[model samples]
Target: MAKVNISLDAELVVEVMVLAGVGSPQDAVEAVVRDYIARGHRTEARTELTEQSLREVEATPQEPQG
Candidate 1:
């Protein structure tokens, strides 16, 4: 296993530990690694950014409704 040194917010770490039923920070980190490797995360970011730009171009100024 590749060893990585990273930091997590204390609250978030606790939350993930409780939900995941993991015993230690390493376990939580490993879970994240497994999930991240299995599911690539970047494609959606690009897609969302593209959609937002398109919406900005297409959005028309709306008249305030009474």
Candidate 2:
């Protein structure tokens, strides 16, 4: 993987390190980013629409009838 360098506040990096329980700041930040990506994938899986669901929705009446 390609590496990029970015600057962050010392206090923020220390906070992330403590929260992630990792001694290295790089490891802590990487852990947080990976966790964030995994969470997004899980959320997408939960909310994803399927072909069967689309068919079911299409079968339902779209308007009210008196």
Candidate 3:
């Protein structure tokens, strides 16, 4: 496989390591890049966040007996 060079914030790297849950920042970068390249940047983060927000809103029904 060919390799390319890129830069990212150290904090962001740490966060990715934690999220990847493999205990290695190098592995996290490789894993993320592989998936991102394969998916061609296709993402649903916004839609998932919207769905989560809606679910939270619906779960907290307004109290009428104030």
Candidate 4:
């Protein structure tokens, strides 16, 4: 865990706490940061899978219908 001193808007912190259902400002901030990081990982994984599938399709030979 890391600790840092920073300033934040009281109203915004309260709103985030309420929306996130967290009791502490620290918890709310941590939850939002974790969620943001997880979203990026998911997006990267999806992009990699899509590229691999496209490559496989391109490499496979097509059959002609008479």
Candidate 5:
């Protein structure tokens, strides 16, 4: 594990610890960072899927309407 020395707000740290259900400040920070990354990944996947669907629709032939 890489050791990092960061200055954070004490009140915010306490809040994060409670919200994350983690006993240590390090664990709370790690959990929040993990959650943030996961959320970004999920958003990226959704965007990719949406673009793929749009491409498929554009590729499909449109029939003439009377």
Candidate 6:
């Protein structure tokens, strides 16, 4: 795997480590990034339009007003 080094605030890194329950700052940041990506994928899956869904919507009958 390729690695890149970036600068971050010491306090921010410590906070991330504490929140993520990770022993190292790198692991904490990596975990957070992975979680963010997974969340994006989940959101995309939920909002994606499908051919079946479109057909179902089109087949629904409208009710007449009382």
Best TM-score goes to which candidate? 5
lDDT score at residue 59, model 2, on the 0-100 scale: 98
In model 6, what are the clashing residue pairs, if there are any?
A: none
TM-score of 5: 0.89
lDDT of 1 by residue, 1-66 (tens): 677688889998888888788979779868977888756657677788999999997797778999
TM-score between model 3 and native:
0.47
lDDT of 3 by residue, 27-60 (tens): 8998888888767644576667889999999999
Please provide, for model 6 over 1-66, each residue's C-alpha lDDT reduced to its tens digit, 9 standing for 90 to 100: 999899999999999999999999899999999999999998777667565687789899978989
Candidate 2's C-alpha runs over 4 A off are 49-66
Better of 2 and 3 by lDDT: 2
Superposed on all Cα atoms, model 4 deviates from the true structure by an RMSD in Å of: 2.0
1-66 per-residue lDDT for model 4 (tens digits): 778877899998899899999999999988988999999999999999999999999999999979
Q: Which segments of candidate 6 are over 4 A away from where they belong?
A: 49-55, 59-66
- How well does candidate 6 match the true structure, expressed as C-alpha RMSD? 3.3
lDDT against the true structure, each candidate? 0.82, 0.91, 0.83, 0.94, 0.97, 0.90
lDDT, model 2, position 26: 94
Model 5 CA deviation exceeding 4 Å by range? none
- TM-score of candidate 4 against the unseen true structure: 0.81
Q: TM-score for every candidate vs. truth? A: 0.50, 0.76, 0.47, 0.81, 0.89, 0.74
Clashing pairs in 2: none
lDDT value, candidate 4, whole model: 0.94
Q: Please give the lDDT score for candidate 1.
A: 0.82
Residue-level error in angstroms, candidate 6, position 66 = 11
Worst 10 residues of 1 by lDDT: 37-46
lDDT (Cα) of model 2 = 0.91
Model 2 over residues 11-63: C-alpha lDDT tens digits? Answer: 99999999889999999999999999999998787667565688899999889
